[model samples]
Target: MESLIAALTLVVVGYIAGSVKIINEGNEGIVERLGQYRRSLKPGLNFVIPVFDTVLVETTREQVLDTDPQQAITRDNVPLTVDAVMYWKILDVQKAYYGVEDLESALTNLVVTALRGEIGQMDLRETVSGRNKINQALLHQLDEATESWGVKIMRVEVQEIAPSKTMLESLELERAAESKRKAAMSETESMVESIQRISRALQGQPNSQAVLQYLVAQKYVEANLKLSESDNSKIIFMDPKALTETIGELISTDQAELGNGNGNNL
Candidate 1:
């Protein structure tokens, strides 16, 4: 009789021990009865139906995951190394537990495919400059894809976008070439504006003959200065006094013609 009573007592204690469950903060536990989901257990102490009920799933926490870098080629035929991060949380524990097998792996592959598809549609320059666009697109695509899995995508961000070494060098060279082209264009505009200003002074301003003579004298000085600085340096034999006299004579003739209304209009 004593042996029978002791066996019953041990069984009772075992039942009590197996039935009690303590879920930590930020955790959830789902109870399964005979391989079927029965009920979900929230944080804190909970009681189950001893040997009949099993803990099926016990997590609903947010998670951060870093995706491995994958190589993708852009529409411009430039290859890129890309990696990203995802912020996710379980919204429905039942669906998260049963809707997918190997949830993390599936999500990772989906992210990579979506990233490659979006990036492949763009050229190298757009892919680099449109990173935010890519981020938004990824978040949108993932949110839709993960809805059935009971996961909510909080955010998706592109962590890195590295191009091949040769591609990077080519991009640098192209940027440098563009810079030089813009600089040349700006200089040409400046030169044109200077010529326009000089033409206006000679055509429409007072003492236009004096302006013309001054411009000719300036050119004479510049030409002689360049000749003096040649690789085979030699003295330029042009007389400054004679040059000045020649300018004076030209100005006098132009002024006399203007006074008689016979000066050239330009």
Candidate 2:
């Protein structure tokens, strides 16, 4: 009789042991009875049915999920290796427990899908420069998609948006070409401004015909220097006879002096 009483007491103690639970702060627990969600347990002491209700899942703290670098393509077909970090937390423990299988994995795929989708809509340059905007947009989209999982996305950070080696080289080449083009444009503008000033200074010269001849001669000298050395460069050939005839019609003595020496080096 004593042995039987001891056995019964042990069974009773075990049952009571399974009936109560204690959840730590910043954490929550999900209770399930016979394979179905019964209730959620908040932090601290909680009571439940001895053997029927089981603590199915416990997760309440904020989670940080670092995404592996995902190979993605931009709208302009530039390939990128992108990675990100996500901040999230469980809002409904019961839903979190039953809503998805492999919660972290599902969330990860969700994040990657969202990331690729957003990146696909942008060019590679925009993805690199507008990282903050991308992060916020990702957070918003994630929050919406994760609601079914009873998860809230607090924030997202784009850790890196690395371009392919080819892309980097291409960008460098583009920058070089752009710089050279700007320099050429600046030189052209300066030349034009110089010509304008020379014309204005000669506006009231003794003979307008001589002044025009001198200006044309100056332009011929300037054009020769500005011509490109490249094999494919174009040259606008002008007839020397036509030019000389035009200058020969000038009768002013100043024009004669210009023809003799003043215009020779110009």
What do the candidate models score in CA lDDT, each in turn? 0.81, 0.81
Model 2 has how many clashing residue pairs? 0
Model 2 lDDT tens row, 71-119: 8999999999999999999998877877998999998998899999999
In order, what is each prediction's RMSD in angstroms?
9.1, 7.5
TM-scores of all candidate predictions against the true structure: 0.65, 0.67
- For model 1, how does the per-residue alpha-carbon lDDT over 1-266 read when each residue is reduced to its tens digit? 99999999999999899889999877788889999988888889999998789886546787987999999999989999999999998888888888999899988998999999999999988999999999999999999999999999999999999998888899897997788568747754764455445644465468765665577666656655865775644555558689667656655655455556644553
Model 2 residue 106 CA deviation in Å: 1.3
lDDT of 2 at 236: 72
